[model samples]
Target: MRRMDTKTTTEKTGETGDNAESPEGAGSAGADIAAKTTEPVEAAEAAPAVEPLDADALGPADEVDKDDDEDDDEALFPDEAPASASAGIGGAAAAVVSAALGVVALTGTWTGKVVAERETLIGQIKTSGSGTPAQQISEIYADAWHSVALVNGVLSLVALLVAVLVLALPGRPSWVRAVAVAGAVLGGLGLLLSVGTYFDLFLNLPTAGS
Candidate 1:
């Protein structure tokens, strides 16, 4: 039989037996083992938590902010920002300007109008064979020239209006400048002819004895 006796060499106050130790020392040893294991585990968790910087807004954070699921969802859906209406307004203005330019190209300049007149003439030829070929061609030119003249007159007035309205608009358009140029030249040429006709320079000359 094995037994712990009171007078044994391992049980006396001056000895420290293998299986018998003071309560305070045992508690201290256990606490040390727990602390060592816990510390290393915590350190291991901390080491790999640091993430490199990336462009992904939904990616993980730095080591210091190692909160897992809570913050990731919050970061992904940030606060709502206001939309810039001015951007839309600017884009719309550009579109309006492009459309106005297209109109001018079709109807504003002499060359543009001449081209359109040619198209209309071709259409007329197709629809109604109303006259001889030479007459049809002559009527086409006549109609086109008259339209050019009237357009010039209207554009002259519009040019003056544009100068006045330039400061009033939200912004200047590319078409406005081009229209102004065409309007000014045609208007000036007509004005000069009107002045000459008024001063009798373009009047009919009298026959020798009539």
Candidate 2:
């Protein structure tokens, strides 16, 4: 009986020790897990800061971009066309106008009729409506118009001759220039005579064929 009692006491003591050891091991394991979780959080909070990107740090790429922009500007604008074509057109228009005026003066009976009226050698012109009287007056004036035409032709011929001689002169003599001036004066005189004759035709002559 005594041996049996001793064995029971030993067994009881062993169970109590096992129960205490299990509780201590569970507490230590829970503490270790909590430390592991909080340690990662602390490390994350103490991490180093990251730097921000700056535009000025782009280096040679910025210069290349500026150069490209300048090249684009140069390509957009070009030089203007020259003024020679416009000047040539203006000069040609002036020449055409001069030619038109010259043609009108040449073809129209502007000078001959005027000269015919001033000459008394033709005879007195009648303003009367009598057809024969008017016809005779026009006939008389017709001769004067012809004479005026001859005078103009002769003056033009003299002018041409003087111009030729002057141009031929090696020294371009003053006398040759004087001859040209004289020819111009004579031509003016002829035109004056034509104007006077035309005035007479209107004044002394009839309005119509009569």
**TM-score of every candidate relative to the true structure:** 0.25, 0.27
Summarize candidate 1's per-residue lDDT along 1-210 as a digit string, tens digits: 245564574466556554356787788899999999899889988786667756565454543266755478567876733354554445444444443433452345766377558756765775465565555544554445445545544444444344334424544456654454444444445544434433436653333344
Candidate 2, 109-206: lDDT as tens digits:
44544665555344444434454655655666655665565545544444444444434444433554454444444444444444555456434545
Model 1 — TM-score against the truth? 0.25
After TM-score superposition, what is the CA distance of residue 173 in candidate 1 from its true location, in Å? 21
Model 2 weakest lDDT span, ten residues long: 96-105
Alpha-carbon shift of residue 209 in model 2 (angstroms): 62
Question: What are the lDDT figures for the candidates, one per model?
Answer: 0.52, 0.55
Which candidate leads the pack in TM-score? 2
